[model samples]
Target: MRKEVFVAEQRVPEDLEYDEFDAGALHVLAVREDGVALGTGRLLYGEAAVGRTGGDPSVGSLGRLAVRKDARGLGVGVELVRGIEAAARGLGLAAVDLHAQTSASGFYERLGYAGYGDEFHEAGIAHRAMRRSL
Candidate 1:
């Protein structure tokens, strides 16, 4: 799913789409009743999340959120993010942070995430750091 959205559609380098953190992150996948995967996301906590969470142990990093082309606008992305946040809360996390693509920042904002700092580029795409208290 990450490959389909990030690597292929978004043109993010394939190597950068999958990283060391994936090995330790808590992944969430949204599926239909028939078992078709609709979207996916991941939560990174503990030491693995330090870099993304600004060294805050009580926070988790949410990443790799992607929805299949056919599943876009069907609430798949929202559920995937909620699932990741629920997992973070289960781990005792106080908050969740994500690097959202600039174009998608409004979506996160609607979900209660507030953006901070200047915009930055990741994989040649404009992004903003956003956070929400759990």
Candidate 2:
């Protein structure tokens, strides 16, 4: 799923797309009735999320959110994000943070995430830090 959206389509280097954090992160996958995946995301907490969340233990970092091109505009991305946030709350996190692609910031903002800090580039795509309290 990520390979299709990030690595292949978005051109995020495969090596940079998958990281050590994946080992312990809570992953979410949205699938159809027949089991075809529509989207995916992950939640990083505790020590694994320190660097991403500015060392905030109470926050969970959300990453790798990707929805299939055909599945987009059908609410898959929103559901995936909500699923990740639910996982964060289940882990007792006070907030969820994510580095959203600048172009997609509006989508996340509509979901109640507020952007903070300056825009930065990751894998050559501009992004901004965003967060929402659980």
Candidate 3:
């Protein structure tokens, strides 16, 4: 499902979409009434998020957030974000961090995330670091 959105639709390189942390990241999947996946996201905490969170154990890293075009305008993306935040809180995290595509930074800001740091590129798409304190 993530491949469908990230690799196929968004043009993110497959090699960059999947990484070493997948095995330990907490993944969340959104499905339809028929069990067809519509969106997905991942949460990385503790050691998994240390590098991304500036070595802060209390901050979880949220990444690989994707929602199928057919499901856009619906609340799947928001739900996935909320779910990731819940997972972070469950792990005793104080906040959640993410590298948001600059074009989508407003979407995350609407959900309470505040962007920081200079813009950078990941998988060929411009991005900005964003975070929200739980």
Instruction: Note the Cα lDDT for every prediction shown.
Output: 0.94, 0.95, 0.94
User: What does candidate 3's lDDT look like per residue over 1-134, in tens digits?
Assistant: 87898889888889999999999999999999999999999999889999998899999999999999999989999999999999888889999999999989999999999999899988889999999999
**For model 2, how does the per-residue alpha-carbon lDDT over 63-133 read when each residue is reduced to its tens digit?**
99999999999999999999999889889999999999999999999999999999999999999999999
Candidate 3 weakest lDDT stretch, 10 residues: 1-10
Candidates 2 and 3 compared by TM-score, better number = 2
87 Cα displacement, candidate 1 (Å): 0.6
**For every model shown, what is its TM-score relative to the native structure?**
0.98, 0.98, 0.97
Q: What is the TM-score (0 to 1) of candidate 3?
A: 0.97
- Model 2 spans with C-alpha error above 4 angstroms: none
* Model 2 lDDT on a 0 to 1 scale: 0.95
lDDT of 3: 0.94
Q: How does residue 102 of candidate 1 score in lDDT? A: 98
Q: Which parts of model 3 are misplaced by more than 4 Å? A: none
Model 1 C-alpha RMSD to native: 0.6
